[model samples]
Target: MTEKVIALDIGNVCIGIHPERCFGALGFRSLADIPREVLFLAGERFERGEISEAEFLDGFRRLTGSALSDAELRRAFCAIIGEPVPGMAELVSGLAGRGYRPVFFSDTSVTHMEELRRKFPAASAVPDGIYSYRVHAKKPELPMFEAFEARFGVPAFYFDDRAELIEGARKHGWNAHRFVSAEEVDKILG
Candidate 1:
């Protein structure tokens, strides 16, 4: 018997964002343009909601010691996110159709979360959605798992590309699969 699965997309933005995979492929290409540390701090702060959009922009500037604008930052983030796995929406709907709750889980900061919300309001990525930074979960964390259990009940299956998340789910007794591709999910569903 195939169990129900929930889908959570971890990315800067989705839905009508002019296609993706350009951020990392472009922004991070030049080491001098953007340092890994700056990106990490921005993500960290955004994930925690410790800083606002303007604050993040300022922090980014200070971190990189560069003059990148919000638009550039958005582009960079979009690139790193790549593109949504093909048929992600169908997957979510399919899981839900089976009586499984398809939820999104991302280790994101509030600033970035807001950016996504602005972009894909239809996806309902946060607030009215399933999970969020307000919950302060960074995935693969016991606390995050506990939060999910509390909010959405125990998840039967967890799909992710992170080993720590898989191990965490294992610790919590969830049927977890390391993300290989859409085919793997299809196989499980089959």
Candidate 2:
């Protein structure tokens, strides 16, 4: 018997969001527009849970020199998250029908995840979530997949928009795909 699992990426795969758009909303033209120190070090710290949400917000405010209120800051930060991809709910249901457990696998911060959970019903439907902050690990890092494998076992199909993440899953000897569209995912899952 093939012990198969399906891991879905929260951003871009099931939902649409561009990180550059988040940064742009914060006033930067691109991530490269931010100071290198903040973008690299502070970003890693924020994603890996080394810093609290408040600290990250403060750092972002200082770096961007934005006078936006905390509420506004959160709005800007979360503004990148857009609508759920069409047919995602049906795809999840179909995956379940095929005996594959669909789980969320994402490199997202607690604040972002909380906002998504509160705003998006599709996010709430997953049986479980494996987040970078919770594990203190992010994608393209071997340990994250190791932790995932330990928790859900190596996924039979890991779908992500980023090639680096897909490569990481493949390095673990698991099948992985670079997600393109809902139709492609539905066909592949079928």
lDDT of 2 by residue, 71-170 (tens): 8877777877777777776676566557778888988888878766765655545768788888898987877787787889878788899998888778
Taking the tens digit of each residue's C-alpha lDDT, what string does model 1 give over 1-190?
Answer: 5444464544421222222243343444554456677656555666655666677767777776656677876656554433355555455545545666566666765544555555443354223333445665566667777777777666666677777777877887887777666567668756
Q: Write down the lDDT of every candidate, Cα atoms only.
A: 0.58, 0.78
Clashing pairs in 1: 8-104, 22-79, 23-79, 24-79, 24-80, 46-109, 46-110, 47-108, 47-109
Best by lDDT: 2
After TM-score superposition, the amount by which residue 167's alpha carbon in candidate 2 deviates from its true location, in angstroms, is 1.8
- The parts of candidate 1 lying over 4 Å away from their true place are 1-36, 111-132
User: For each candidate, what TM-score against the reference?
Assistant: 0.72, 0.87
Off by over 4 Å in 2: 1-3
